[model samples]
Target: MDVRLGHGGSMFFVRDALRKLTLLSLLFGMAFRAAALVPENVVVLYNSSDPESEEIAQYYRQARGIPEGNLVGLALSQKPQISRDEYNRTIRDPLRKIYEDRQWWELGKNQSGQTLPFVNRRPVLAIIRGVPLKIGGSPLPADFKSDPDDPISKRNEAAVDSELLLLGGLDAPIQGVAPNFYFEGEKRFEDSKLSFMLLISRIDAATVATCKRMIRDAIQIEKTGLWGRAYIDYSNRHQMGTSWLNSIQNECRAQGFATVADRFNQSFPRNYPLSDAALYYGWYDSSVSGPFLNPQFRLRPGSVAIHIHSYSAAQLRDASRNWSAPLLEKGAAATVGNVNEPFLQLTHRLDILNDRLMRGWTWAEASCAALPVSSWQSVALGDPLYRPFHHLDGSGEEIERDRDFRSLVKLARKNSDPGQRLKAIETLAAKQKSGILSEAAGLEALAQGKRGEAQKWFKAALVEYQSADNQIRQYLHLAAIARHAKQTKNAAGILKSGLSRAQSFPNSAALAEWLQIVEPKPKPKPKATSGS
Candidate 1:
């Protein structure tokens, strides 16, 4: 009787243990599913190298309904100085500036006497780089003059200190702008573009990285810098109307800085564009603190800051005088009251932000001059689907991959003719040797929110034909363009249309890839609504 009782008790304990294990398994499965849905935020660094950047930003912004504040703009000076080969050592000349008689900072500190609540609200930071050469009409401070033998050692110290402050080394992102490009213009030179290239060549990647870090760390907001990267440099001035001006308005609006757009267009009363730069204009005459606050519409002539990108002397004078420049263009001069002059003028300035500005001469520049280093970047706008590298690996395989992609990219970029670019891509598609499969998937992902499935298909396709990189690249370009219109099905169709040709000539090496993207059964579909 005792042995039977013991056996029955042991069986009961075993049954209880199994039930607990099942419950634990169910809980863990739920947690894993939840983890998969975790969302992430992406901050795009952009500047107007092409129209697509802004359009891409806007399309995403509107499509996703991200708050205006989420899509921010960063400021940079893009002035050309000189062009040099990649290997040649280059020297960056020191920019000089001396404001006469006017204590601009003091006036700015206490201007309008009304209010600057907004300025205090937002953070300000600075970024400084390059070796210092001199300081204010005197020897540099003694504290930093490590080289006693150098005659200008004292001068260099003060300059160094100023540069450090400008770079916001202390992490106080209160105000950061390049004194050279911010106050003056780019230096006058024989060939502006060539000069700019030379200057940029002198700037080491370390200095750029330092500046980028400063900007990112200084912003008080949770999000770091989301400024367009293209406009960050002082050499690409032509990209402005599309990148700079419009970004000013968009970022200002997003940051809760402005009420009226006119405040941005109007020139300040006393020729002070720098001091009066603000985020927004108030109900009557008040302005908020941010990028759009222009003390004077035009900057001082021949100054290092504006020298890179200032309008003509006559244009500057007109802007400084009282915002009286002819707002009309040759095509629209006939339309009088019908045309809103301030808006039109502002739009002209803002037009720099639009990619369409690159339509005529720019199309060629973008097509031919632009260089893509690898297969992933070979597409005109640079789709990273072809090459599987964010940074080059420098391996033998990587070198070969890089060279092959580079050739294809050069092939695409070498032609300014749109028809030729298409023809080249189509010809490769017929052979199916190498191409961009991920790009097609990216488009598909954008269209139907079936990102995983699209990714699977792209990976599978690439696995099937890594050798034919060109065909893959063309399909990727098509995907980027289609993402704007919310045509997921059409994007998918592009893949299907070219799939047969893409697979014909496959890579003998590389493994077969498999993936399927699916949404949660789409909530079992709703019942149909019928007419009553």
Candidate 2:
């Protein structure tokens, strides 16, 4: 099967099948080229003074089949944040010494007369729970002056993981940010000249148990692939950020991933019916809120949820505080956050991260590629080696084997024509009784301005949907269609019925708000009283 995808003015063909013999050869070639960073190339670092750190490290090593000798322990501060002096003395210097002693890398001088790592044996590092999370209060030398206009250049505080990326080049200045040599690079870490720089990610969360669960979820999900809806919230506050999210939302829809996107000014409201969120990307919130605030809400296992904030990862041990910790507590297997105020331009690009991960890049590789700078604020939390979509290698075997809603949607997208695509999806949805597919078809119709078709699909989806949250979303979609058609009464009726069904649900608040908007009560007559 030859699948053609149209992008801009170009058409790209994806060859999924050929003659049996040729197809077998192609599969072998793809498999040979898909070799990623192996367990042997990873080193697990843990805090020697913290037992939980060692426990998490050992558990991860066993789970990922990493060699036992790869686990390294260092005596480090247990606090979430440490002083610059404490970081250099207890963490940085000690870890560098251990790397040298272990012959992990050989240092050399670059053409610019700066020290660099030319040969590297271990390029991946996993910092476990119990290790200090961020470095605090590192001031530049008094003799060194920085541009007053560039505030980012004057800050020196950093995430411990970010600072460690410069481990191979100790001579590099700590102030401001260092360009990540691997950022947007096509070559794999081991194949690049800057292999000396470590691809670091932390396996830490709000608690030891959550950290362990994250590790387990990553490994398990890699076998089957992460599946479910992608929730993208666009704040419309920044054009660059909004554009990035728009790209991500489009890509998710094209690839048959069920996606719900909010393009409004406000963030997803509290008690929003966000369910089965397998991938979430939103921004500008200081802490976790929205559906995440609902005590019963939890992300799909192995889900990657990221909320861009200056201090998203300021403190990972407190679940109620920043975005990272609370998201982890809510069962997100992987997330990227900033330990401090990383300027918007320097933070991880969510679109790049999603695109890379979908292309089967490891968590560490995707995270590093998305980040434009190192020795800065971002910290990626998850199993560093996790590849959420490793199973979907374009072989078509996985899709055929699973035949699930995600696969069906992917197959339907092979049709480039919008009308044909919707028809294909509707056929598959009916054949499989998939509420997700019905919902996706409705969204596609709505995007094409086919309000009547969209309403039918949404009504079908409402009946097919099993979860109350999903059903409520369908109601909203149907009501919006009715309102757009100037059938206010119809819209009100739909919302009222949905509200009646949603009374016991946490998301009922949204229904009530919509009801007030569509069908407000009339003001009482006061003329008789005035006359008296």
Best by lDDT: 2
Q: What are the clashing pairs of model 2?
A: none
Expressed as tens digits, the lDDT of each residue in 1-532 for candidate 2 is 0011212222211111112212222221111111238998799999999998999999999999999988999988888899998998998888888778887766666555555556677888999999998888666798987765445556789898998876775434667666676777676665555645788899999889999999989987887787777888887767778888988987776777767776656677677777778899987777888778888888888899999888898888889988999999999999999887776767898888998887778999999989877788899999999988765544423433245545645664586666787788778877877777888888777767898888888989999988899899998788777866778899899989998897798897777766776798888877755544
lDDT of 2: 0.78
* lDDT scores of the candidates, listed in order: 0.23, 0.78
Worst 10 residues of 1 by lDDT: 330-339
Each model's total of backbone clashes: 77, 0
